[model samples]
Target: MEIYQAFLVALVACFGKFTGDIGYFMFDRPIVLVPLTGLMLGDLQQGLLLGAELELVFLGIVSIGGATPADVNMGSVLASAFAISMGAGTDVALALAFPIGVLLQMVKMLIYFFRATTMHKVEEYAEKAEFDKITFMHFGHCAIYVSVYGIIAFCSLVFGADAIRSIVEAIPQVVMDGLQATSNMLPAVGFALLLNMLWDKKLAILLLFGFVLSSYLQLPVLAVSIIALTIGLIMIAQDRSSSKTAVQTTGEINEEEDFFNA
Candidate 1:
């Protein structure tokens, strides 16, 4: 890869690394990151295709409460760079994604740990009322993160492209097929995680209902979604109405008892 291309990708990774929490620009998402990488490398479609696939794979792997689930954004950056550089199609890119994200997640976890150690310093600054020092430290933290990923991104471009291509080529045909198969299964695993965290039996029944409506009746997804939204709104309305009626009924009962007592 050209030096400029590598630098551009590192720049993208830098933006993507902190954009999730800091920038809130949505570039940290694979949907945006992949296309940006592809655009950087003059292969926008390649990036988009890869992005769409990775987006599904990591769909539910959101970071919450300072948890680093996986650095899937970094995976998107690396996988797209390697794929575009080596002309490895999206399937092969998908195969590499999870592993790459896992590796980058380690890096992210380490940063989070080290950053947590700086809380004492932040506390000291707060006690001293040194607000400027706090701002300085925050910027320093950002710079360190950007530089860490930027270096990784640059070096990957500088030295990792041929290695990744060779690794892809060295794998057996069956293994490659297996990788692709596993890649397809990732979305299912992601959904399973979603269910584990946010599952409700009632919602599961609703989900099954949607599945049946689509599969059996051949209803369009948008139509089914609209129906679901309408049902949800109606449920909310009914709950409010029921609560109000109970309140009114209790008020009438108390009024009747007071009249009898009087």
Candidate 2:
């Protein structure tokens, strides 16, 4: 019954937007999707807890252009579902989910390749000036992509979780320890992704400030985020002020030139 529910949840999640590849991060947001999966399994609280941890780990996972970094949707759903069924806590579930998320990323890359094939048809419609056809083609491509996601999600819900639980249960203590070690390393992967996006020489000072506040002062993540936002606002305000002053100076110089000409 839970399996059936998971299938419905996956279907709604993937196809509700009428496009499956609705960009990985938005639909795959663990906070939103994990709770839904939990509700389906009749364990909403556990789902929320697991989802929160998974969210922290994958907070920096993003799709840039044609690249799908990792499949958070599959990871969160599978982890939450398995954990709930096995009565495991969020930490244990997260330990299991991180590696699965990395594997799912490869599946997403394959999906990207499949979607690319439809682009030629889209180009043909553009060349023919058939705007409606182009729209239809794009929609069709989205449908296909979503269908693939839905199918994979449904299969995992139906067949994979139980199999995974069996294998996990059979693993030696040392292997479980190894899994925990790998899980501990996953945050670094997420941080690396963030660094790739956010690393700028100009922003080095901001990063240092955040690190000091969090590490030395022991500030909460929320507090650090708020402080960072405030700093960003101040910087933006200064830039705007500088731009306004420059514009005013340029206008004054223009006026002086006109007077000299007159």
Candidate 3:
């Protein structure tokens, strides 16, 4: 990639990273980030497909409190950038994404550790009733995050892309094939993880229904989704109707009791 292209890619990465710091706009998601990176890299279609694949790969991974999950946004951004720039396929992107994400996670942890020190200053400002200073510290930290990670991404693209390409080229075809197989299975694993977290016997039927539609009927995803949505709306309406009937019955019983007492 050219320097300007790399710079633009870095900007995309920074935007992804900064999404959380600003608010939960969810621009950091691989589904969003990879396509933007791809657009910057001049391969929107490839980026879109890769983004969807990467989204599945990172689907169940989430950050909770101090436990930071892998940096999916950064990883996806770089992976798509590399893939598009090299005219490579999803296999290479998948092979590179996890390590890149983990590396960025480490960087995030370090950044958070150092950024924690600013809390002391924030507390001091809070005590002094210096609201402006406290606010500055908050936004200033966000700015720092953007600048630091943006530079890291910029450097990675300009410096590491060639090195990575060389390494990938040196790998044996058998290993590349193995990576491709692993990549193909990752979406299933991601879904499994999601199901493990959200497993409910009552809802399992719905899951099976969707599965049957997709697998046996060979229905498209949109059709299955619409069917599910219709079912959900019907269920919700039934529940509301039941509640309303119960309320009416209770009201009638109360009126009867009052009439008898009078």
Name the candidate that leads on TM-score: 3
Per-residue alpha-carbon lDDT of model 3 for 118-166, expressed as tens digits?
6999889999999999889888889888888899989999998899899
| TM-score of every candidate relative to the true structure | 0.77, 0.77, 0.89
lDDT tens digits, residue span 138-243, model 2: 6777776677667877777677777877877887878667766766676678787788887899989888889999999999999999998998899999999999
C-alpha lDDT (0 to 100) for residue 107 of candidate 3:
88
- lDDT against the true structure, per candidate, is 0.85, 0.74, 0.89
How does model 1 score by TM-score?
Answer: 0.77
Candidate 1 residues 10-85, lDDT tens each?
A: 9899888767646677679898898899999999988888887787777788878867676788988898789888
* Candidate 2 local distance difference test against the native: 0.74
Worst 10 residues of 1 by lDDT: 18-27
Which ranges in model 2 have alpha carbons more than 4 Å from their true place? 12-27, 59-70, 89-114, 215-218, 258-262
- What local lDDT does model 2 show for residue 47? 76
Please report the candidate that would top lDDT against the real structure: 3
